[model samples]
Target chain A: MKQSQLIKGVLEGCVLAIISQGETYGLMQALHHHGFPSLVGGTLYPLLAKLEKGGDIVSIKKPSPDGPARKYYMLTPQGKETFQNFQHQWSQLSGHVNQLIDEVHSNDENPGHPG
Target chain B: MTKTQATLDEINRLTEQLAPADQAYFTDLQLYLSTAGLFYDEAQLNDQLLNMLLDLREANQHGQSARAFFGNDPQTMGNHLIQQFPQPKLRDQLGLFSLLLGISWVFQILSSPQTAGGLSLNLVAFILVPILEICAIILIIRILHTSIYPNNHHQWWPYLLTGLIVTITISLIVILNSWVTVGWTFLIPDPWHTILLAAMAIGATVYLLGALLHRWRHHQA
Candidate 1:
């Protein structure tokens, strides 16, 4: 609870979801809108490598106009299915979370959750 | 802006933190981002899809684990303390061995008297320097044993540099000693000096052989 298992689940969900598409370049950029550069080397490479090795993700090389060739990691057909499964689980979990958020009422004057 | 540009922007900041030489790996990272944007969020998804495909290719190539290849763990929030750096115990062992050998060399010299003149010089060189060189070579062998093979943790190029430097340093010490004193030996006696030189030569030979053995092990791995 202290670590927020939900966050890890959400991250895996989001990462897996990205792979569901054909392929990707920088996941941080795609997911940056959610929260990205916030977790750089610490969370990025090892996760990407693991996801690739796990057989849920596949990475390849494609030439880049700006620089050298870029490695693109894409979710396989299997990865797409995984993404859907995680998505489904997340949806149900988020619904309950949303209800909880809605139930908690706070005065406009004290929104920060203080004494 | 275009999706690629927008996605590139978000990740480029994080990419900046990596070393300049590793830029290509970042491009692959960019590709990963572009793919994920297609999916919004879902309840549950299969986690092993991409990995399974990669495994097939890497299987022929012999798949390397994240911990072995990148020295990192992906399951947690940040880099695991164990994965981020080199093993400390090995370095500690090397340092301890160096200290002990240096002390032993000093003690050996202090206790042994200067037998002859040039003989003394040859004796000390044959005796003392080999201890230092032996310890250094042993340490190098230990490091390379753990550092090479199917899943080397370190970048290989730097190890080459360390080996070259260690060899030259030991050679320099020997050459300088010869220049200052009675040639190769301590001028003990005519024939004994030759024998002593031969012994010193043997010490250098053993040290060089040890280095070669280490290199061979590294290549095989």
Candidate 2:
């Protein structure tokens, strides 16, 4: 039941990245649509607090389509930088792993070992 | 159509999983709304409740008293609050209920006769209570997900699930009486289960009655 340290970073990082693209509400809805249900209305409070405190997020009081003011969160330029850095690191790691996997698959098919 | 009725329904939903004292807070909110020239109606009531929730969240976010201290207009403040409110849930209910049940479960397992805690002065239950408390927590989350969350697809299903789960979990000790008897002969049987169940039943009864009473009082007004 323990989430790996990597997954935790990825999930939280992805949330911030998604928020950088738009408002928090839409980000939450998009996450849910993508089957990441971490926005259980409970998990978000602390995560938002942490992200804001970390200077990776900011919230503005904005009106919604329904005529109510909601707090909309977006990334600052610094946050965008953080997002890009994290994305690059993650892609580098995953890409290397993928290449290794592909090499092993091709090796298995070729059976280069002496018979 | 009245704001009061709308507020009542809205408050009912927001504070649905809250206690009588917590419910009273919403009544105080109603009084505030009625002061703003809003005829108490269900729609405006929902609006008010939503506004109050936003106000509370704002207070939490900024660590201030509704952000304006005191010099602001009430209706303007209220409308501003609604523009930024999030949907409400029973976070308070879940917290208190989880805590109480957690204490109870820890008491049961630690006070378990076969355990070393039961063999001694049961101080071990106090110690072991915290140790196993982590697992109880995980179990509690699992319980909420399996036994309670599926019902949240419906509007009132969460309420029913909260009531149902609380009732059933409190009854676990009763149903486990045989196991306790066989496992530990010297441990005296406790009635906390029955007491909590009875208390819960009465609380539910009083709440429903209180709703009707409020309705009657509002009519008389």
Candidate 3:
């Protein structure tokens, strides 16, 4: 699969995981600091809106210590539920992928070890 | 320019180069960040905006278009934003359908010749027309309320209740008009009977066609 396509699938799950920690500063910041620096506001904001619409997350305006009131997004009950589901799916899928990678590495070390 | 002023200048320059629609997207993002983010200070907000511009510049240098950096074009993103909110167009179309039904019924009543002892075109219209009009108004209100508030399939209740009421009302009007226009002595006589059937058929067909179009557009989203 294309690299961007691969990142696209897991990006939302990662964003949800970040929000699951606590209310986010800005989801784009979380994504950027987490190593997905290529993502921009145009992509991130719309995803946040879509997630809010789907009831996965909700935003509330709160007074900021130094600036204008900021909208902070917290995971809704539905969001937590979806995050748990993604966690389980990712664990299972990654476990199988890891196993295949390990097999490939082992085979390279001992080329004639297995038929 | 100082570092801060230089960042602002670069942002302005890049923004000026964008197509109007893309520029609108940049404006929307600015508004959103300004209103929503827990920025430590105004400086942080500016830094974030600067970062976004720098990312765009980097993407451009790497041979990616501005839209590629954004991942989707502005129009597609705008549509996604809209789909999160229920459209007013649905209610608008409902109004149009109600108008069409009213006009067709009025035409059916006025054009038919009078018969002995049957309810006159004026009476059927006077009695049922207002009721139908009221029903249409209620239906529109219900649609607006449910869409604005968004309470699950509770939204569907207004639709179902109003739909059932409208269907029953139209049937009663058709059956009554058919009775009176044919003759008071006859229950469901010839030409008016056929006309009533035709009206019902046409109304149902038109309504279904409208609903199908709505579904198709939404599915494309």
Candidate 4:
């Protein structure tokens, strides 16, 4: 699958996780460092807008030390709940996929000895 | 002054190297976001995008050519922006009314007014004139309440009132002297004369009724 498609699937949850700590421009740097190096304002702002529109997050303007004032996003209670559910689903889905891969690997290794 | 401010200025300068279409893409995105009620300043958004462009430029220098341009389809983004506001029903209706009124008015101007008798009313004009007049009035009323033309609510009242007064006065003169002798059609030809007279009558009634209703509402208020 395309990296962008993978990122698209979980970017919302990742954003929620980052925002849970604090809202900062540092979030952009963190996203870049954490595997979304190509993620730009074009993608991020629209995602943020959709989140705000959905009532999953809210923002307020705060003075940034470096440049102009920045809009800081904070998750609502509904957003937190949604993120927790996402985490739960991710854990289960990833675990099942891992097991399936492991089983496939073992079967390949023992292909000649199959009864 | 500050290190960060200097860096931002550098970033802004570097962003100028972007193609005009790319720059416009960013500009339009900023506008859409602002109109959609995003609270962030436009400069901040521009800065973030600029930083991304710088990163791509750096990568390109190192032999990796990432498309710095934001590849999102503008139409989809426009749709998202439009979803923020309710559908503008009055504006949409006015748009359709204006089109039909325009078509009928054009037909009136083109069709010959000189028939079996000296001066004859074309049957098409006879039917279309009333509909055109009614649609025009409705459009004016809608525009007065909340202008679809200017898109500014504050200036609508003045424009509406002035338009109403002028249309009514001219319409009154035309209606009163429907049979006045004309030496020449002059600048405009024969059919245009009847068309203008009909237009005046329609415009006058529309203005008079609009003024009365407006005054009545103001008095109530």
Candidate 5:
């Protein structure tokens, strides 16, 4: 599958995870820092809007020290709950996937060792 | 000014700060986003657009081009963004329809030629023409919105051809309207004609002022 298609499923939770930290630009910075450099404002802003619409997050426009007011995003109580749930689900899914991959690699290394 | 207007003003001011190339790209995106969705939550859409614009400006300051900061294909991105907006309520659509119908009805009354006997109007034309005109307008807007994008490189001939077809179609409809005078004629006597025109003008002015005031107050709230 295309990497973008794979990311599409978890991007909402990833975004919520970032916004849970604080601020809008930090979400972009964090995503880039974590290796998803292709995700830009075009993708991020819409996801942010969707999260806001869903009541998972909220933003307040505050005056920035450098320039005009910036929208600072924060997790609502609902958003926090949703993010915690995501964390639990991701951990379980990743653990299972990793165990299966390790088994496949071991089987490939030791040919004819099935049972 | 309403908050919406204030947000719009801020958007205009910040849009000027973009580099020429970036400005053009942003303008095309703005036009598409604003026009493609007719009845969405306008205030929220503007707010989000402003937020995006601000981010683009910051990225520009860091020497990143708009296409680099905001993806290459605006059409796809715009469609995705528009989907996040709340859909328009039925009442909003009906409100806009009524407003257009009311304004067009008044305009037709004022522009039609008067005669010695009275102001003659075709009842059929009065209702049908406005509806047809509204449909034409929506069609034109849709065409214009779809045809516009920063990367579209088709020649001008197609646009010119489309414009010609639209003009001819509307002209034919109008001419056809004028010829229908059988059971559809309505006449107002001279005194009532004057009174009707005066009343319509006054009503339009009052309604416009009231709407503006309400919007301003709503923003203040």
Candidate 6:
């Protein structure tokens, strides 16, 4: 699958996880710091809008020290639940994928045994 | 001023503080988002845009350009943002339609030739022309909107086709007004014509105020 498609699938969960930490103002920067460096405001803002629309997150405008009001996003109860579910599902999926990769690595090491 | 107007004014003010390149990019994105449709929740869209502008300014302070901070493809991002906006409520659509129709009706009444007896109008043409004109306007807006993005190709043909269609529709309306006199006619004597115009003007004003109030309340919430 294309890398963007992969990111698309998990980006929502990643956003939820980030918001679940605390009220987040600079979401794009937060996502970038958290390892999704390629994410941009163009992508992040719409995703945040969708999450707000879906009732998973709420944004409150707070006065900024140096500019106009900034939108601070916080996870709703529904968003917290969603993040928890994502965590559980991610753990299971990663575990299965890791086990499969390890098995394939062992098979490759023992080249003649698999055939 | 209404909350929406206040928000828009603030947006414009903040937008000016952007660097020239960032200002240009923000203007393009603003046009794309605002012209995408008539039915989306505009107040919410403005709020989102204001927040975005603020973010862009902050990024610029840290040495990032708008394109760098917001990504290169604004069209795709704009589409995604618009998709998430709440669609206009059905009542709001009906209210807008009524206001448009009311304004058209008043104009038609006032513009029609007045005579000693009364003013006569071809009812069929009077009703059909306004609807067609409204539809034509919406189509023209959509056509113009799609051409706003620089990356969009196949632009000239759409404009040409739209111009041709609009010209034909307008000509048809004019012909119907001038030549087609066979349809049912309506007559309003001088006194009643004045009253009818007054009534329509009032109705349109009410609808306009109601819509503005609704938008203000929605923004507050």
Best-performing candidate as measured by lDDT: 6
Worst 10 residues of 1 chain A by lDDT: A36-45
A20-100 per-residue lDDT for model 4 (tens digits):
877644455568778898775446656766777788887765665654445567889998998899899889988998999
TM per prediction: 0.36, 0.35, 0.43, 0.46, 0.85, 0.86
Q: After superposing candidate 2, which stretches have Cα over 4 Å from the reference?
A: A1-6, A35-42, A65-67, A113-115, B1-13, B16-221
lDDT of 1 by residue, A1-115 (tens): 7333445556766788766665777565566555542434345555665566567787776766744445678887777887889888888988988876665644345678642
Per-prediction CA RMSD (Å):
16.8, 18.6, 17.4, 15.7, 3.9, 4.5
lDDT accuracy of residue B19 in candidate 4: 58
Pairwise lDDT winner, candidates 3 and 5 = 5
Question: Candidate 6 at residue A40, lDDT?
Answer: 86
lDDT of 5: 0.81
What's the C-alpha lDDT at position A4 in model 1?
36
Model-by-model lDDT, in order?
0.50, 0.52, 0.63, 0.58, 0.81, 0.84
Candidate maximizing TM-score? 6
User: Which candidate comes out best when scored by DockQ?
Assistant: 6
**Candidate 4 lDDT, B54-162, residue by residue in tens:** 5444444554433343444543543444453333456655666676666555555445355433344444443546464654555554444233223355765758665
Q: What is the lDDT of residue B213 in candidate 3?
A: 88
What's each prediction's clash count? 53, 16, 1, 0, 0, 0
* Cα lDDT for residue B68, candidate 6: 97
Residues B1-221, candidate 2: write the lDDT tens digits.
35446545545565554445434444444444333321223353455356445544433344433222211233343333333333334674456556666655545544444533223223333334344444444454444434321334556654575566556644653444433344334432345434544665686699899989878887687
Tens-place lDDT digits, model 3, residues A46-91: 6776788789988765666643345677999999999999999999
Off by over 4 Å in 5: A23-26, A108-115, B150-153, B200-221
Off by over 4 Å in 4: A112-115, B1-22, B28-69, B81-221
DockQ-better candidate, 1 vs 5: 5
**Predicted complex 1: CAPRI docking category:** incorrect
Model 6 lDDT per residue over A35-96, tens place: 88888887888898899999999999888877667789999999888899999999999899
TM-score of the second chain in each model? 0.28, 0.23, 0.29, 0.28, 0.83, 0.83
Positional deviation of residue B129's Cα in model 5 after best superposition, in angstroms? 1.4
Better of 1 and 4 by TM-score: 4
